[model samples]
Target: MKLFFQNKLYILAGILGLATSCEKEFFPQPPSAKVAKETTKLEASFTATPPLSLSDAYWKTADYLNIPLTDLSKNELYSDGFLNMTGTFKGLSSFNKGEDPKVMMKAAYDKTRVYIYIEWTDSDFSPEFAASIFNGPNDPLKPDTFRRWTSQGNSDKVALAFDIANASSATGTFDVVGCAASCHQNKMQTATGSVDIWNWDLALSDPLGFARDMMTDGTKGLHDDEGDNLASQNKIIQGNSRSAPIFEWDGTQQSYKRPDGKITLLDPGFYLLNKTPYIGDLDKGDKIYHDADYGCNHCHGEFGGGVGTIGEATAFASTGFAGKYSRASIKSYSASELHPGLSYWQKVPAANQDDLIAYIKGLGSIPGYYLKDPTGSSANIWSVSNVVRGRINTGSVHTNYKVILVRDLTTGNADDVQFLSPKGKSFPFGVALMDHDGKNHIGSLKHLLTFKL
Candidate 1:
């Protein structure tokens, strides 16, 4: 249900304060090793038309609260094996160690949608997600792929969790432990309840203008709520022990059409719209370059860079070249065209060129996940991240992400949380902000969203 869970939770009332809020007055509670305590409340003041963008006037009408946060670095207690990797959180950039990022939040509601806005400072602008790096034949993602997913380069993320029932687990109440009530040893679940999760994945769902709507119950634990499958891994299993990407860009039309009839410009280095499945002979491609007699790595190293160009190594995930798509784009129609100046450029066979294309396009790094038009109940939350797509801030100051999320007030799904008026004006919730980490986050807890009745 939750992509990443932190022992620390922050509740900034966009008055959708943590994606939900409480009244503005906050009473500090004793801090624990993980969670920072806050008694926060905010009003989801009514709006005629719920705003979905940060520029909407709804922001002008409501007051945002400054919430406290705890540096829950490696929340390993109930992480289900997911842990924040120290020193690598910022990917290729230097982490701003002493800057106490000021976290702010606010919210609003209309007849159909509930909205929340949260923003914070980050030292680095990490927009790349997990990329399929060519780690020879021993990459862990080579399927049987169970757990321990880390982004060689990463992006910023925010999430909100709300209770769907009178819930309890691990001897804690939803009102008390917040998300911990449902998080367990190896899975995210409530001992006796369910939760509605609004996960804003920067690289995954944001491109589709959505916050993945998900849920977790006492039984099945966490899962994507039924509907159109929006995004999934771009990998395919080639028998066992070996795996490769299933799709790649075939053309240069920026706005490629989706199977569902929606057309959107695919983010370069982040998405693949034109699709061509792997139909070439890998054996032919391998022998032409990596073969002992041919040896592409002799000059370009294992995958791309070697003696003269170690700084440009294609196989390793580094700062500017983290994800498969990071700094990788489609052009010129030929792999040899990518490096025409190199020796033996024309020596490669056209019939086996795809293997080189796959090696260069697929190997230099590729999207860890692919986007599709979502369907069904899964499309509940519509989101807009106020950031320029496909561009990273290399300037002196890091950018602060202003993310806006909107969802139906009462999604009639059994697994989702409902916030009907009158009896349901105030709902307690938890929310988190990850700089570059998936598991560990800085967040606020105990914020209640009170709809202005």
Candidate 2:
């Protein structure tokens, strides 16, 4: 009996061992499936060359790229004919995340040869399609394949627009307008003649309103010059190159003294920054009005400086002066009465002059040229995001993805207002700001660059 019992126990033990081995073999987990590799990075690069000017004040540095007008010296003596800006850039990204890109301006100069660099990332990328467009009355329709150019504005405005991809990354790339190859065929040839200097692209999105407020005095409901409020009556004195005037006067009430002498205007009205010139109604062919009377030639220097019977001033005043009988209606304002060349004349085609003025009007006045400054973090910014969707087909499921609007600060704003990328990099889905809407109050001042460390 003992032997039989011991044999039974051994058999039972063997059966239990077999069961344990089967459980270990069947229930063991397989190594976790390897994770999929990340997609290759996207990248880009950009470059630019700026123009230089003769005056030192025109010699801009990165510091002025985003300066406030209030900080600008009130004295008309220290004017930089206009702000110039430039920059170098870098970026990297994945799957074209499609977020709003940011950028920074690095430098400013008056010289024409400006050097700029932009870099971004992508599996396949090219700078060939990247381009720029200056949005004024002059710019052609967007996606502007032809990139047409028109006449400049009264203030000699120039804007630089850039198209960029992979904007958030350090290797992102960009291209600017108002440069070679990208400019319009006819417009490029006549670029110097075109105006509309406001560079909305260079300004930050938030403070655009502030910039407009100060320049146009939009918030204060004020304008640059009218009656006695202007630093200089509409009269632009010889030797005065600064933008803001040094003196204010009512043409009829007081004599405008150049630091050296006092003079009276044949037309005793204040020049309006926003309104049309007093002689707007004058016909295009009327030889009576010359450019100097409007003070355009004072800074520009008569087209070729060729000697002429009527100086720019005499020519301009001629329309008002014409026949001697109507003296009281239009005073006897003569180049001799004030100073000979003070009212010098230079002749240009009326069509060309009108075109030039038309361009200038599009750019608006000096302060009005740039986009307004930032208002607040929430007010002047935007965000973008990436998302995915699932689709099922033929007993299988596939995943799809897309970029979506995460946030938009530009809503409810006019076309002129929008947020700029942090460093001036382009955002594929980013907002396009008007001359009055952006981060830094001032837009890209032609050759200026606001660099950040």
Candidate 3:
């Protein structure tokens, strides 16, 4: 009887163990993702010859370190920009986990430059900047009702932070923090430390082929690196305490054919770049849009473009994807831009053309910024992404981002960090990922980088 009872007990214990293992494998916990094996130190080995191209076959041989990114939307300064979709957007803490919250980083250095490569997944392709579609005419009593931005805002971004002085750790005292040290309350501003920031903005800087080089010092927010700039805000404040984009494509569509035969657009990028300054009267556009006799109200309904589906139609009542019909279905065009494959422009009467365009410009998806190539210290870090160069998978629901950032091994900029000689034997840094957000991000701290000699 004793032997039989002992065997019975063992059987029960085995069943319980199997259940626990199954639960552990299936029902995983949050704040951590199942990713590739992580390496301790990120090593940058010296290479005598290296191709600097983003899609080079030579990069396949480099060793990489995988880093996990966790939820960072709980900071005091973490904001969801004009659209507050925290815990709902596609990332770490979001209910709908879209992207795998992991980054694979690789490093290599030549005689003159250091190259850093990173790859991560993002579900959405948010290339458009801020547009101004749903704004109403200057209303004195309700100025806030018709603000500039809407849900169709936010851009994708990634940033790296390094110690400027002996400030490798976040606080310059304790080595626990990484880039989080720079972020004091809102943006990164330490009480006694400074950091050199390399921000790669998909919308603002990528189109111009550079990461924005910036610096932060004791309690001071982010500022530009001396010499050149990557971009500037193309905003203009109007009478009702609201702002609008100061520029637009002068009804012209310009494009650039890449070496890969990808035709990248250079005009009306949703943001202005080499486009004409905006010259429109919102009141005039609004009047022509609602004119019963000659208005598009017959087909597009009361407000925007589609029949009550678009934002500008109901003054932005309808939501995302530009109200079913989409801008692609009905977009402005020029004879010069017309190709054998398509046509989205209609020849409207010259009298109504300007007014209709003015109203269209008032809608939200307009660009609140503009771009220019960088120079000086700011241009030190040459950057590229798969999205900008038309190197990404066009058919995927959400594509991955493979970015390459290369900079001089020793740029003698007063505001920049130097990685000279044995001093760079070991370096600590931080990285942040922003998914359609300006402030809130998911990142890790205190990642050590070592030189492989």
Best-matching candidate per lDDT = 3
- Per-residue lDDT over 261-297 for candidate 1, one digit per residue giving the tens place of the 0 to 100 score: 3445655466554555644454455566575544565
lDDT of 1 at 390: 44
lDDT of 1: 0.59
Off by over 4 Å in 2: 1-150, 153-281, 289-306, 309-336, 341-453
Tens digits of lDDT, candidate 3, 1-453:
999998887677667757776544443457663243346777777877764666665567667788877765443222222333233244466422554646889888878878888888777755544444445233222223534433335567888888886443244431467776676655467656678888887767766667889888775568889876876665675322235556655444445432233457643534356556665566766666666455554445565545632222233322222222123233433223652212212434556555556555555345556666567887787775676433322234765788888888789997787888833587788888877665667877768777777
Candidate 2 TM-score, true structure as reference: 0.21
Question: lDDT for each of the candidates?
Answer: 0.59, 0.22, 0.60
Model 2: per-residue Cα lDDT at residue 232: 18
Q: lDDT for model 3, on a 0 to 1 scale?
A: 0.60
Give residue 226's error in model 1 in angstroms.
1.2
TM-score of each: 0.73, 0.21, 0.73
